[model samples]
Target chain A: MSLKKTRFKYLGESLIEGNIKITAILAIIAVFLIFFFILRESLPIFFNGEVQQEITFGKFFQGIQWQPVSDHPRFSLWPIIMGSLKVTMIALVFAVPVAIGAALYSSEFAGRRLKEFIKPVVELLAGIPSVVLGFFALIIMASFLKNIFGWTYRLNAVNAGIALGFAIIPAIYSLAEDALNAVPKSFREAALGLGATPWQTAVKVVLPAALPGVSAAVLFGMGRAVGETMVVLMAAGNAPLFSLNPLESTRTMTATIAAELGEVVFGSGHYHALFFIGLTLFTVTFVINLISWALFDGLMSKLYGAKK
Target chain B: MNSKGHLRKIKDRIKIGLTGSAVLLILAILAVILGTVIIGGYKSISWEFLTQPPKEGMTKGGIFPAIFGMVFSLLMMLIAVVPVGVATAVYLHEYARPDFILTKLIRGAVNNLAGVPSIVFGLFGLGFFIQFIGGSLDRSLGQSGLFGQPCILWASLTLALMNLPMIIVATEEALRAVPQAERAGALALGATKWQTIQNVVLPQAIPGILTGVVLVVSRGAGEVAPIMFTGAAYYLPYLPKLPTDQFMTLGYHIFVMTTQSPDIDATMPIAMGATLVLLALTFSLNIIAIIIRSRTRSQLRKGR
Candidate 1:
C-alpha cells in the first residue's frame, strides 16, 4: 500500500527520474573527485620512499625557502604561504573599502539611470578576463607605477596586489550591492520617518541590517583573491621570499602550483610537492566558500523572516 | 543644539562624498585598463592579424589558430556541461522528495566546487585525467599512449566541471520563476509529474539555461590556469582537429608571450592584440547574456 502511493503512473518515468538522480549526484561526485585525485597525488610525499628521502615533515618548517630545484632541494612552504598572505592582505585592504563604498552609493544615493549605468559598468569590468588584467599589470601598470614612484623592483607584491585588487572589486561590489539592496523597502521608509537623513538611514539602519551579507561579500572576495593564479604569476616577480614588505617580489601558493607543475617530472618529488600545494589551496578555499555561503544565505532568510 | 545639528549635517556630506569618490576610483581603474589595451593594440588588429597564424617567432601574423582552438574546446565543454547542469537543476526543483537537507547539501557542494582554486583543478586534470583514468583506459584496451596524454578532451571536461555550478544556479533561478500554480494546473488536467515538467517547465527554462551556457563559454574562453598542463599548448604548429590533440588558447598565448618569450618587446604587440580580441569576445557574450536574462526575468515577474 505504501509502495502504491509512491508509484509512477508511467513505467519509464521512474527510470528517467532515477537516471536524473544519478546525473545530479555527479556534481557532488566531481567535488569529491577533485579532492580525491589531488590527494592521491599528494599522499606520496608522506608515504613514498623516494619522496621522503629528500623531504621530511620537519624540513618544511625548518627551511625558509621554496627552492624545489638545485643539487639540494628545499620544500619549505613558509615563504610562499607568507607571500600569499601579504599579497592577499594588500589586495583586500585596497579593494574592500572602494567596493563597499561603491555598493553603498549605488544602493542608497544613485538615481535609476546612474544605478543602471553603474551595474553594467561593474559587469563589464568583471567580464574583462583575468589574463587581460594580468597583461595590463605586467606591461602597462608595472612601468606606469615605476615612473610614479621609483622602486627597487618593478614587479612586486604591491604591483600584483593592486592588479589582483582590480580583479576582485567587481565580485565584492556585486555581492555588497545585493546585500545593500536586500533590506526591506519599509525599513528605509521607517528610518526616514524617524527623521534620519538618507545618509544616516543607509549608514545606521540599512548597513547594520545588511552587515552579515556585506561582510560575506568581503569574505567571498578574499577567497577569490587567495585562489587567483595568473595575475600574481604574471605581475608578482616570482621570488619566494620570507618578508612582510609588500614591495618585495613574492610567489603565492596558487602561483607555485601553476608555475612548477608544468615543468616538473611526472612522478618525482617536485610533482608530488606541487600536488601538496594544490591540496592546501583547495582546503583553504573550501573552508572560505563554505563559511561565506552560510553568511550569504543566512542573511537572506533573516531579512525575509523579519519581514514576516 | 543648533551648532551640533550643523556639525552632523557636515559629517553626512563628507561621508556621502567619500562613497561617491570610491565609485569614481573604480571606474577610473577600468577606464585606464581598457584605454591602454585599445590604444596600444589598435595598430596590431588588422585583417591579416585576424586571419593568419603567428610568423617569425610570433612577432608577426595573426591569431587564427588560437581562435579555432578556443572555439573547438568550448564546443566540447558545452556538450559536456549543459545536460548534467540541467539535470541537476531539474532534480533539485522537481524531484528529491521535499528534502531541504539534501538540497542544501548539493548546493553547498556546488558552491565549494566553484571556489576551489583553479590551479588545483589543473593538477587534478593532470593526475586524474591524463594519468589515472586515461592510463587505466589505455592499459585495459591494450594501447600504448593514445588516451594517456594531455588533449583537448581532458581540458574541456576539466572546464565543464569548473563551470557546472554556474549552469546549475542559473537553471535553478529560471526554474524558480515558473509559478507553482502552473505546475498544479498541469497536474490537475491529468498531466503526470514527468509529463508536466517535460511539457511545461522545461520549455520556459531554455532561455535561462542558454544564458548560463553563454556565460560559461565566455568564462571558459578566458581561463588559462586550468588548461595549462591539461591540454593547452604554448605554440602549436597545427590546429587541433581531434579530441586527442593539444590546443592553443588565447589566454595561454598571452601568458606565454608575457612570461616565457625570449623577445618580450617584439611579442608584446601580438599579445596585446590577442587580449583585445579575448576582451571583445567575452564582453559581447556577457552583454548578450544580460539582455536575455533581464528579458526572461521581466517575463517571470509579469506572469506572477
Candidate 2:
C-alpha cells in the first residue's frame, strides 16, 4: 500500500510540474502588461517628436522647458525632476536619522514591554491611509508649517517633504529594527567580553554589520517618498514652475500626473506626455525597488551566515 | 588628563541620554497623533451620525449610506480577492519547484507588483474594470447601468484587483512558514498529499492566513484613489441597495467634503467622523488577527 502511494505521489508531482509552466507564463504576462501599457502611451511622444520638435534624443534631454500641451511645446524635464529631487532629499534628511535612532532604541535600549508597545504604534503609521495623511498635510500641516516658517506659499515642497518623512519614518524604523535584531547575540557578547560598552559594540560593530540591511530600508523609504501622490498634491502647492527653494511653490512629477492627467485629452499629445512622466517615475522607482530588494537579499545572507 | 576623563564621562552620558530621549520622542509622537484623532473624532461622532442618513451641507448629518456602502463593497471585494489570491499562494508555495525559471519570474513579478504605486492601480482600474467590464455590465444590465457609469460592483471589483498582489504575497509568506515536519509526518502516515494539505497544513496555517486577510481588508478599506477613478459617487443620496447601484463611500465622502463641496466647514466634521469610523473598522480587523494569533499560540502551548 505504501509503495503504491509513493507511485501516486510521484504521479501527482509530475502533474503539478506540467502546470507550473503555464502559471509562470501567466505571471510574466502580468508584468509585461504593466510595462507595455506605460510604454504604449509614452512611446508616441518620442516617436512623433511633436512636443520636442527636434526629433533628436539629445535635444529632448537638453530642452529647457516642459509645456506639453502648448502648440510650440516645450518638454524640458528639469524643473519637475528638480522638484521631485528637492522634496525627496529634504524628506530623507528628516526620515533617516530619526528612523535609525528609533530603530536602535527599539532593538537595543528599550524594555520588552515598551518595545511591544512601540512596535504596533509604528506599524499603525504604516496603516494610515495616504489620502488621510495628505488631507492632514493639506489642511493642518501646511498651515502649521506656514505659520512657523512664515513661508511665501502656504503649500510648498517643505511641508509636503516633512509630511512624507513622517509617513515613511515608521517603515524605515521597522525594517531597520528587523536588521538590527538579526545581528548575532554571540557577537554582542564577545564585544562585551572584550570590555567594550553596549554603546561601543552597537555603534562600532553591530551597525557596520547591519549596513546593507539599513541601506535597503532607507532606499525603500526613499522610494515611498518619491512615489507618494496625495501628500505632495495637497501640500506641495502644485505650480509646475520648478524652483530649488523648499518654501517656494513647486510640483513633483507624481503631483503633475495626478492633477493634470484626468483633464488631458486621451490619445492626444498631452496624454502621451503624462504617460512619459509616469514612465520616468516608474523607471526611477523600479530601479530604487530593485536596489532595495537586492540589498535585502544580500544582507539576509550576511546575517544568516554570521549566525552559522 | 582629568579633562579627558570628564569628556569621556560626558560622551557616555550623552549616548545613554540620547537613546532614552529618542524612544520617548517616538512614544510621544504616537500618543499625540492617536490622542488628537480620538478626541476630535469623539466630539464629531454621535448617535445620529451612526444611525441616520447623511444630509448634504450638514455637519451633524449621519453616515448610514456610506457605512452600508463600505460594508457591502468590502464583502464583495473579499469574495473576489480571496479565492484567486489563495490559489496563487498555494501554487507558489506548495507546488512550484524552486529551480523552475517560472517560479523565479513569478517571485520577481510579485515583488514589483507590491511596490507599484497605488495611483497606477487606479489608472489600470479605470481603463480595465470601469471602461471594459463596466461598459459590458452597463449594456447587459440595461436599466441598472443606464444613465451614469461606475457602479458599486465595478468599484468593489477594482479594489479586489488592487488587493490581489498584496494578499498573494502575505499568504505565500504565511504558508512558507508552516513547519516541514508536520507535512512529512502526515505523508508518512499514508495520507494523500491533498488530504495532508487539507487536514494538517491548512488548519495549522489558518492564523497566518487570517493575518494576511486582515492586512488586505484593512488596506482595501483605506484605499480611496482607485475607487475615486473607478466608481465611487460624489454624493450618493441613498444607500447602494445592490451591486449595480451607485453609492457613496467614507473615503470618497471625505474627499468630496474637503475638496469639492460648497459647505467646507460642514464637511470637515463629517470627514473627521468618517476617518474615525474607517480607522475603527481597520483596527477591529487587526484585533481579529491578534485574537487568531493568540489562539494559535495557546493551542501550540497546550499541545506541547
Candidate 3:
C-alpha cells in the first residue's frame, strides 16, 4: 500500500525487473549512441589526412566560399553558418512576439470556452507536418510573398523563416502559456488586491514572475528554428550566401546535410564533411535544449517549490 | 477614479486588445494555411490518386506507393518502439524511486531526446545503423550488399529512436493517471508488484498507450528526414517486397516533388495531392489521439 517504490517480493522478481530495467535504459542508450556515432563519423574530417588535405579546421571557419563540388572544392562553413544564423534570426523575430502574445491571451484573457477552442487550434497547428508547411511555403506562400515584397528571388530567408515560425509557434505558445498559468494564484490575487487591472496583473506581475519559463520557451523556439530542416530545405533557396540579407536565398546546416547527403560518396571527404555538419548541429541543439530544460526546471522549482 | 486612472484604463484596454488580436492573428494564419492546402488539395485528390501509383514522370496517376510505404514503415516502427517505450514508462512510474540517480538520468535523456533535431536522427541512422551495424552484419555474415544499405528496417529503427521519447512521455502520463487506490487494492489482495502492474495497471493504461501508439504512427508517417537516407526513395517501380528494399513515402514524395522534380509545373498538383494526403493522415491521427487522450483523462477523473 505504501508505494514510494515497489519492492516486489517474488521468486521471478529479478527476471522481470532485470528485463524491464534494460528496456527502461534504452533512452539513455539511444542518446549515447546518437552522439557517439555522429562524432565517430565526423572525426575523419579532422584527423584523416585525406579529408584534412582537402579542408582544414582553420579554413573551415575562415573561408567565405562553401562550394563542395568544383575543380577546387572548398569546405568552408561560413556562408552556410551565416545562412543558418540569418534564417534563425528571422524566425525568432517573427515567432517570439506572436507566440508570446498568443500565450498571454490564452492564459489571461480567454474564458473557459475560448481556452478550449484556442487549445485545439494550436494543437491542430502543431499537428501539421513540416513537409506540408514546406510545401505551403514553396508553392503558395512563396508566390504570395513575392507579390507583396517583390524580391529578386522567389524563395528566400523571409519566406522560409515565416513558415518556420508557424512550425515552431505551437511549442513556444504551449510552454509560454504553461509558464504564465503556473504563476501562482496568490500573485494575481495580490496584484489585483492592490487595485491593478487584469492586464496589469498579467503583463507586469505574472509575466515577470514567469520570465524564466518564457525565456525558456524562446530558447526552445530558437532551437527548433535552428535545427528545422525540411521546411528550410524546400523553401529557402539553397544558395549559400554570405550576405546578411533576409531576402537572399539561404542554406542552413540542417538543410545542407539533407540536400547533399543523398548524393555523397561513402567514406569520402564530402561524406565526412556532411557528418561534421551533423555533428555541429547536434552539439548546438543539444546545448540549447539542455539550457532551456534547465531554465524550465528552474522555473518549476521556483514557482512550485520543488513539488512540480 | 482620477485623471491618471483614465490613462491607466486606456493602456490596459490597449494591451488587452493587442493580445487578443495576437490570438486572432495566429488562428488566421492557421486558417489560411489549412484553407489553401484544402482548396488546392481537394482538386488533386481523386479515387485513382489515392489508389494508383504515379505515372508519366510523376505528372499523372496516384500516390498508392507512398501510402503503402508510409504504413509499412510505421508498422515496423510501432513494433520496435512500443514495448521499450511502455516498459520505460512503467519503470519510471512503478519501479524506480523518484530521486534515484538512474531515474533522473533516464528522465533527462527522455526530455533531451525530444529536442534532438529530426535531421540529426537521420545522421545517426546513416552513421550507426547503415554503416556501423549494417556494415558489421555484412562483414560477419560474409555478405556485402544485403545488410549494408538503406532499407525500411533501418529507417523504422531510426524513426523508432526518434519517437521513443514521445511515446514514453505519453505512456508515463497515462500511467500516472491510474489512481493509487487501484494499486493499493491490488496489493491488499496479496498481489505482488508485477502481478498488480500486469493485472490492474496495464488494463486501464491501454487506451492511453493506444493514444501514444497513434501519435507515434502519425509522426513516423510524416517524418521524412531520417527515412530519406535510410529507406524512403524518390520513386520505386514496385512496392517494397523486403525489409531491405527502399520505398516511396508521402512526406519524401512531397519533398522530392517540390524541390527536385524535373517537371515542376506538371508535378505540382501531384505534390499538392501528396501534401494533402500526408496532412490528412497526420491531422486525423492527431485528432484521434486527442480524442482518446481526453476520454482517458475523463475516465481517470471519474474513477478518482
Query: How high is the lDDT of residue B130 in model 2?
Result: 58
Report RMSD (Å) for each prediction in the order shown.
2.5, 3.8, 2.8
lDDT (Cα, tens digit) per residue for candidate 1, span B1-304: 9999999989998999999998899889888988888888888899999889989888888888899899999999999999999999999988975557777678777888889888888889999999988999999999977789989999999999998999999999889888898899999998888889999999988999999998999999999999999899988888888999999988999898888989999998999999989988998899998899879877877876
Off by over 4 Å in 1: A1-9, B1-7, B97-100
lDDT score, candidate 3, position A306? 27
Residue B224, candidate 3: alpha-carbon lDDT: 87
Considering DockQ, where higher is better, how would the candidates rank from best to worst? Answer: 3, 1, 2
lDDT of 1: 0.90
Write the residue-wise lDDT of candidate 2 on B1-304 in tens digits: 8898778768976896687676567667556555655766777788888888767464668787777777788889999878767767777888778788877888888778767766666665655565555667667777444423566777887687667787787677667667799899999997876677778887777777778789788877777766765667767666777777777777767666766667777677777777778777776776666566556656666766
Superior candidate under TM-score, 1 versus 3: 3
Higher-TM-score candidate among 1 and 2?
1
Tens digits of lDDT, candidate 3, B192-222: 8888999999998999899989888888887
Judged by DockQ cut-offs, the docking class of candidate 3 is high
Residues A1-308, candidate 1: write the lDDT tens digits: 35665463556688888899889888888889899999998888888888889776666787688898898899899999998999999999999999999999999998988998788788878888889988999999998888899888889999999999999999999999998999999999999999998899999999999999999999999999999999999999999999989888899999998888878988888888888888988999888877887898999999988888
Task: Point out where model 2 deviates above 4 Å.
Answer: A1-27, A48-76, B1-10, B51-53, B57-60, B131-154, B241-246, B294-304
- Each candidate: what lDDT? 0.90, 0.75, 0.89
